[model samples]
Target: MSPTPSPESMLPLLVDYIVAWVLICTILFLGAQRLKAKIQFYAMQSLGLSVLLGAIGLAHQNTKALILAVVAAIGKCIIIPLILRYVKRRVPMNKGVESYVAIPTTMLMGGGMIMAAHYLTNHLFYNQSHLFNEMLSTGMALVFIGMLVMMVRKKAFTQILGLYVVDNGIFCLTMATVFEMPMIIEMGILFELLLGVLVMGILVQRIHDSFQAVTLDELEQLKG
Candidate 1:
């Protein structure tokens, strides 16, 4: 009879699966054209991240991981998305997505960056846990794609979402590299993100109200 697999043995595979799901969500976010679709993809990616943290907590019996997972879910998955939806409703301008690069070209760039991320991390974290390597690679991919979105997208709202994606990447990298951070620090990071999102949302709404549009192109008239 085949022997039963231990949780320790399965943990790496589970982590890889969740990270891959998050990466896929990131790619979908890159391809998404509508503000609503982008918000949904970002929420899904963050939900995967929260789940990844929860799984790590369960496998390692770490209370901090569990707390962080819950906080991430509340802040990234729920509250942030709600704020985005509110912004979408208030900002009637730029209902269609606008990008400096075509979607196909952006997707190709995103795919290439994912490969580059894996290639870069594969050697550096070879001595560490395999799970660390997977998480780091996915984190790098998220950051790359997020920055791409910020650079190519013309809308303030999309850029804000891209910033959130980069933030999420940083979160994953922190967890992979330093899993035992103080609970207060973790809570502080999430609180700061929540506060930043709120402030950015308000600012975006103000910009739309003032300029009558949210696209960066439209705001170029403010140039001195």
Candidate 2:
């Protein structure tokens, strides 16, 4: 048996779900601490996002939004994995190991980012839309966290993951907080992410061939 949702209980939970969605995307984009873990996390996050979007669409009764939600699930969750598998077959990634910043430390910073986002969006940007602005703030924070992850981690593969997070953050900000963009816009984003992954897919081979070891840290010789 489940406890019923009071009006008060409902709103925060919804916001939390959106925040959780952002976190999932952030983790996906920020790169995983381990290779197998990152892949699994990405798949799980996409699935979670898909479910949330579907629920939001139904709850809000926005037919177009629901359709877009389904599209996100398919693209982010399934298609990306297939592409990743192909990439994996081609290159031996030197990333997916312990990071320079350390996972626990990065998490602490990420927590700080969420708090800062809330503080800014709540007090400074208070005049913004009452409904979705918080989500926007959360997205921004997640993007920033992803950026930090990229900066601190020297691995090229992880850097690409950071880029992925930034994309997801923007996508979430647009879809959840801003106006419901046309389906074409969402499709464009999916296409862009696909292209990025495809292009970077080749980089894996380049890294292995050039350095003989794929770690970006060793590539620092190029830093004249």
Candidate 3:
């Protein structure tokens, strides 16, 4: 009989699963219409990333990865979502946020970004394991998708969610490739994310109060 494969041996499969889910969440985020739905998708994506980090920690017996996973779960999945939900409740929801580009076009652009990421990863990580290259490419794709979301969406809330998506991509890359990222550096990144969210939330509230709209188009009129 063949010996059971160790958890370490299954790491690649686990990483692949999480990476796939993250990509799905990114797509859902792009397609979502309501601000609340976008926030939910971001939270789900963060939870998926935390799970990936936790799996890496368990496989490697790395306490830092485990702790970082906990922090990410609490900060990104729970606290951030709750805060965004509060802001959502306070903001007027009747206004529709039109995208700069159609959904189909945006999706096509996303696919092109993924292809570009794959090509870039191939050249940059030729010596790395196939799984590593795949994860890194997925991370890069997420970054591009996040930027697309920011560019296409008109709402300040959605734009903030896009920023979170970008941050998640960076986190995915760091955790997947350098599982040993210093705890202090991870904490600093988390702090910056939390701070940015809080500040943005305040700005969003002010914009809604002042302009009676939270759309970027409205804000742009203030540039004069």
Candidate 4:
């Protein structure tokens, strides 16, 4: 008879699911047309990433990883989304996010990016375990997707959301590989991200107030 699978044995599988959830959220973020929907997707992605980190922490009995997970959930999933919503309310702009590229084309590019990420990870970490490679590749793919969003989306708010995605991706990479970053370093990163978001939010509001639009193309008139 086959032996029952222990929780310890099942951890890698659970991590796979959590990582998949994060990737799915990124795809949803890419496909979503409305600004609010994209923001919500980013929040969901953050929550999923936190879960992944927590799972890894628990598996290894690492206190720092667990604490980082909670901080990530609170900062990324809750605070950032609230700030984004507030910015949305303050800014006068179209409800829908304008894309420089068509949805299908963007999705194709995203798929290609994922493939590229996988290739890069495989080349760099050929000695790593398969699960580790998967996690790292997915994390890198999220980073690429975030950059794509920033490039294709017209609104400053959506660009900020993309930046959040990029930050989450970096966190994922760290959690997957190191599994335990120093508390001071993590705190500094969190503070930097929060400060950046606040500054960007203020800049976005000011841009809207001064230029009457928040789209990069619109803001480019000031480049002179």
Each model's lDDT comes to 0.82, 0.65, 0.78, 0.80
Off by over 4 Å in 4: 1-4, 180-204, 207-224
Per-residue lDDT, model 3, residue 129, is 86
Residue-by-residue lDDT tens digits, candidate 2, 123-210:
7777776446756776677578768866877766555656655655566566555345566456646755675665565655665575
Model 1 alpha-carbon drift over 4 Å, by segment: 1-6, 183-191, 194-224
Q: Which tens-of-lDDT digit does each residue in 22-128 have in candidate 4?
A: 88888888888888998899899999988987887888888877887888789888987887787777666688988899977888888899899999999999999
Which regions of candidate 3 are displaced past 4 Å?
1-8, 187-191, 194-224
Query: Model 3: per-residue lDDT, tens digit, 9-92?
Result: 688887888888988888777777667777888899999989988887888798878898898889889988887777666665
Model 4: number of clashes?
0
Q: Compared with the true structure, what per-residue lDDT tens digits does model 1 show for residues 1-224? A: 99987866788878888888998898888888788898999999999999998998888788878987898899888888887787677655777779999988998999999999999998777787688888888889888888998899997778878888888888788777555556645654875567576557676657567665445555686773
TM-score of each: 0.84, 0.73, 0.82, 0.84
- Better candidate number, 2 or 4, judged by TM-score: 4
Q: What is the lDDT for 55 in model 1?
A: 90
User: Model 3 scores what on Cα lDDT?
Assistant: 0.78
Ranking by lDDT: 1, 4, 3, 2
